[model samples]
Target: MLNKFTTKIVSLSTLNNYSFIIPTYQRPYVWGEEQIKKLLDDVLLSFTTNKESIYYISTFLTKEVGDKAELIDGQQRFTTLWLIALVLSEMTSNNSEISTFLKKGDELRLSFEIRDEIKNYLKALLKKESTSKFLNEHFIKKHPYLENIAEALSTIKGYFLQLSEDYNLNEFGNYIYTNVKLVKNTTPTNTDLNKLFTTINSAGIQLEQTDIIKARLLNLIKDEKIKFSRIWESCENMNNYFERNVRQAFPNWKSFNFKKPFDFNDNLFQHNEDVIVTNPKDIFSIDDLLEHDYETVNINTDIKSNQTEEINENEVYCRSIINFSQLLLHTYRIHLFKEGKTDFPEEFHSKNCIAIFNEMIKRNNTEEIKRFFKLLWKVRFVFDIYIIKWVTNIENKTEQLELMNINSNTDGYYSRTKYEPSSNLMLQSMLYFTGDYLRQYWLTPYLNYLLQDFDNVAPTNNSHLEYLEKMDNIISTRGGKSEKELSFEYLKTNEFTQQRLDIEYFNMHLGTGFKHYWFQKLEYILWKNWKDREEKNFKNYRITSRNSVEHIYPQNPENRIQHPEIENKHLHCFGNLVLLSVAQNSEYSNKSVSVKKSMFGEKKHTYDTLKSFYIFQSNQWTPKEIEEHKSEMINLLKMHYEKTFF
Candidate 1:
């Protein structure tokens, strides 16, 4: 097994000796700010903890094509690494070590096959002195295919700029070049590359850490291993509802009754009827667990047909905010907190979850392992019912945060209705965008709240919305507070202490430096209090993953003579800025105020930020209007804060 493939661990610095090609069949660069930020942050954490220690990135599978290697997998991470090197070169003077991996002489070390424009873009990026100038010149011209690459570059630049002065970039770059390592697994010459790519994408050939954890837990209870495995498999499919997962995984369990979509009872896991075991052997390995797939059984043919047809017509195209690993951590944290343990971690990091759980199970008895899985089932059920998912429309490809209402028919079959934008959705979207993308701290407290006496809690009551509103207030005004101070226990007993909202303080921050929280929070405020005739404009509005801040009045107006009265002081203040997606921000680049105003009106959907809609609604954008709008927006935030929390 080990003779045919050549495998070796190589550092970023050693990659300077090799060239790679991204085949045309590969997807375009699709890593967004969330992904780029997570990779950089993970590396930075390793660098800070111990610069001398080696940080092992994942493996890369490639085939040797002449002197160049064709990337079969790991293209996204590889492209991101190259972009990091590019950003580091631009920001610092002594970047020879980093630049060597980016290029060899005049030729780039990485190239896209048959993508001439992308190749030219990469070359131009190397020659330009500043990434910002290159992005402005090329991205503003509307290369729709390269938007992800451009957005990634922009995110990398901003991430480095915001680092504290104490952290030396030169040292960090040196660490990245020398200490960060990836395993390179090169395929043999006779291997069929096409079949390899298809197999890698369509199937899971390698065992994950989660699978090992499941194996370890199941090994503890030999008598109930089948039951535990079913629980684990059901919880793993985060995209589907828990009721459906349970039905599919435990098809032979006749006592199970999904009376409602959110009905999760502890007794539901007991084997009231005899369950057919496909593999009855007592000694099963991790590979056996990984290979096992549950056989689907139709409960009611008539209801199942109707459900299938309805789902196919209006498919709920949605993605979970957190993955299965993070879900495990969330469920585990709640478990420990309920047991009156205080040593658990406050933040969720997927890299650390395995080690944390290993330590946890080390101290647990067999009974404890069974209890954990039972709790996981319940937590996942409540999660699907109460949390917001990134739901997209099939026809338009436009996405919004949606809390879907689960509907049940007379035969007790469950289906989901189309989502309508509500306060619960808006509030969660605000938190989702404003907080750390990798670690959702808000979920710990919110999920814990829903799980309390969960069997008795009504999913239709307004209590869920009220609890989220209070949590938002606490999170918003939590200025420099520690996580311990904002724990679930603290949320249960505390009311928000009103803080003075300073208009002048907010006015001082300018440009991209302005906090995005204010802009997003204002959108929620506007939507809640909206009574205007333009109700259609905002009725369907929801917060999205926005990072770029756009200036309503162009900083360098394309037609310079249009709005000269706006002074530098009022130019970049809160009133002039709106949080927008990267594509929308580039599309409105440097246009005159009137041109921007016209573009806003022509669009059928609502503005990304409702504040922008109101700002552009004015007849003119002079200094006087900026000052008045600034004051008015601040007053709205101030009043809303006071009313909601105090």
Candidate 2:
């Protein structure tokens, strides 16, 4: 009678009406990078390769109550799957249909019975906050178990962050809800579950894998199960902190992928000796975490007033999006001498990167564990400083900000202008080189000397000048050319700029979609060089703009050319693509040259006047003009920057 239980191969959608309660007596959610990656890869592969096929995601043992199920044996798997659903919900939070499916009364309500804090955390997550952000602000500072959950969640979030580039969230969510099945075994309500669950595992003492890990970690940090657990769990989600903070630190970071926890996390704390010192009040204290409730914790404004340093809302939002694996490869190859001190391979591939980190903890060295967090904070600060550039050094890039400042002079007449950038083109150029997704080969080394106060990438002091120099050397080494160098070479060197162009370099990554940022640059460049200059500089023009690239000539033109011999490849060349506002792009979609030009003047503010002016320079568009304009652009841009293509 104790052995008998019901089983069902139900789709996730079927569980919309049923809530899940992970009993606190169960182990903490310990699915690290290995389990997180596998589940994501399997589910994604299933969704894409065979949409209709049912993927059996192992058995989950639970006991159904009135509207909820008490997870008995398969809590980890169920918790992971529930997290996957949360990821989907997060991505599509704006869609009413999906929002209802994810959060309505009929939809699943996952709560932890043991820790109301953890349950409160989940409830906060559904309210559209970054999981890692919530982790750091609340639980990571205090609760050890939640820290583990946070790391696992971060790894999970990081994987999906990568997949989001190639895979459709809507499709993935649909398949996961409607097709993916799991064998759920509900034990009879009368069974002695604690003993049964314990017997099912090898530990035999009712100890879980988490408990075993806890026991092992306990040796390193004696008399502090609570403290060590908090530190250890935070490391697991350490990747999240890296991904989120680094993204805001640099541009094009959102599309970056960190497949493993150690990818960025371990590199952030490669060595323990180099601890960055900061005020104790800067970091949230355990008392601060415990004193706050979910709402209070979620309200970042409440915490900032008590802090020694105040970060603005824009900076706070900027720090929330991050990805940083490519940099890890650099550190992996150079700093670690091609391998971790532990046996885990030195290469920066696969989820097993954490193996070396686990080996660090396995040493039972409390200092080593402590060092990891210290280094992590240092790296976090470094990334945080770079994010400040979004608000700080932006004027250097000639970025047109939205804000307007007004003043009254002697006559009491109002005068107005956007605040100006303090720096020049070099700052913007190198910032984009390191920040851009496709143009990542020219990356700088992580120099400790370049580090100043805080965890910021850019120093707070004069060392930042050296960081800028390093950026130039790195970018130049990896084939990125400055506007000045390229412009001079094109004009004086008589650079065969167009012919030497790598056609594939312009090709967008199918997975990462890295080419779109070029339009922003191009838009800035075109506006800067506009023959029809306004009193205000293009860089300082306060106008709302969309960064989406659209083909000036229709990609698939309705008005067929007399010479249809032109290849489709030439259609996407820099000559043909132009930055357009969303509404403007839709209006000009597949329209003929004559028609686009007629309205181009009307909506000129939404487009690059130079590009539009050049387009209207001809009566009709053909492969000949496309080639001519391509060379013209190459020539004009080179002349503009005094640099040229090889």
Candidate 3:
């Protein structure tokens, strides 16, 4: 019969007989703030309304009552309420009422197998640690277990803290009384509850197929009518079959998925219409699972509504890759247990284990699993390179080499050792590589070596000079240029010097560098001055390389026809020594023209300065005028510099 449950404000003492059931698979006690606030709010509201005969309750349907109440459903909510009660008990002056409540809740004891774990949980609650600490300490303390309680505890604690200021004790208690409701006398079987839990909490880490299989088998074996000893013996008998068929078939299964029992649905795995029905030849045993032909079932559920982002192709691929990688744990576990190797660590052999790790490619069939495989493979190859560089004289290309101070030899063979690496080294290498690629984008093999010592990565005052030395050596070997080399070639090169002088010094100082068309004006000015100087019979007229362009004038601009401006006839026009070096012209900077004429009389060349000056004066001064333009002169300089650089 369906039993209707209602809230009642029965004294805490009365609750002793009515135990709260939290199944083994149910999470440890976790009460975060939000849940605590909700409870407090509800209790406060109830007090304001003067509600006396009400109690917040949850209903559960289960197959058994003695021992631990096999949690069918409502584990998260129930465990959270229990924690709140404990906190309330601590707050109240009287201890008897709260003690009674706890006694009743603790009446359903955990099986002997997990008694230590149960004790640990109770101890954590009694202590004044953070809610997360309490739950994680018990549930997630080690490997292969689920911690539903931790989340619950966190939520409940956070909730209470929020309401502490606004609501008084009475009001808070009442709020909880009204809001936190649990149905009474609800009869849901363990299987039913497990199914519901799986369905509701499918988003995080869904139960694996093998977990469901194990659940069914466990449920069958747990039956009182069935002799458990015989079942165990049968399991032993069918060990080979189970391992060969079930274990081998689901090689990638993880125990985390089997935290709870199975929720069987007939429709999910329906019988086929292959009609030769024979009397059961062999009774189903845990061992004989291989011989049995059970149809597999998987449900296709929609993505949760709470998911904010639509999964992209990359995300899908990544998730798949992670899932496949996780399967190695099962394979390793099987090998360890079968070989009786109790000392073997439960961690997966990702480095050496050869599973179906596929590469993630852009083409068809490229998914997360594939990507994970490729990434792992690439990292492995890089690690191999590091090792090769380390053992051999070759320089390592990876960043790790620099850290290790290993010299780089681009061309070197990777040396092989006859001995296999120790387990610790292997594990360390795996972790280092995994973290490096996944976190840092660098897959340096040197990380494997660096991470060997815990203190190396620690933030302490220990000297890291040895490591730094190794790193420098590695950097050198790897062909990374030193700072000294960079300074010489890139910093102090001649090209840089030229660029600096041209832009910083010459361009800003004189307007001469400004215009490209000013060369003609400059030439005209020089020629006219040259002629005046020649007429005065100046000597020592020699061309200079520094300022050499052309000499067309006498000492005065007006000596020929370019310009008539004159102070002394020796006032050289800007065009006079256009082609002479600055050094050569500066030697006669303020000298008179007669001085140069006497010096030049010794050499009677037809194209001497005086003769050349007349020839320039004979030409139309328009050409000279144009040649004297500053823009043309500047252009000529610009062209020369550009050509030199180019």
Best by TM-score: 1
The C-alpha local distance difference test score for the whole of candidate 2 amounts to 0.47
TM-score of each: 0.84, 0.40, 0.26
| Model 3 whole-model lDDT (C-alpha atoms) | 0.32
Ranking by lDDT: 1, 2, 3
How displaced is residue 91 in candidate 2, in Å? 24
lDDT score of residue 210 within candidate 3: 29
lDDT of 1 at 373: 87
lDDT string for model 3 (297-376, tens) is 23432111121332222110001111222332322232222334331222122332332111111112323322222233
Clash count, one per candidate: 0, 21, 114
Candidate rank order under TM-score: 1, 2, 3
Candidate models: Cα lDDT each: 0.71, 0.47, 0.32
Instruction: List, residue by residue over 46-97, the lDDT tens digit for candidate 2.
Output: 5765778777777787877666788877788777777777766777664412
Compose the digit string of candidate 1's lDDT tens values, residues 1-646. 2226678899888876678899878888889887887788678867876789788878887888666789878999998998988888877865537756788767898899977667778787787735544345565356655667877887787667545244788788888888999998888776666666654554433445676788777777747677777777778767766667665566433355443334334465553235442222233322232245423212221111111322335436567888888889778877877777764643346767667787667875788888888888877877887788867776689766778777666645566665566777788888887776666768877888887744544444467777777667656666666443465444354545535555566778466666677788888888777777357767656677776778888888878677575667888788788888776777787899898888888878666678888898799988788889988888888887676656
Error of 2 at 97 (Å): 25
Off by over 4 Å in 3: 1-15, 27-58, 66-68, 94-99, 105-115, 124-166, 174-180, 185-646
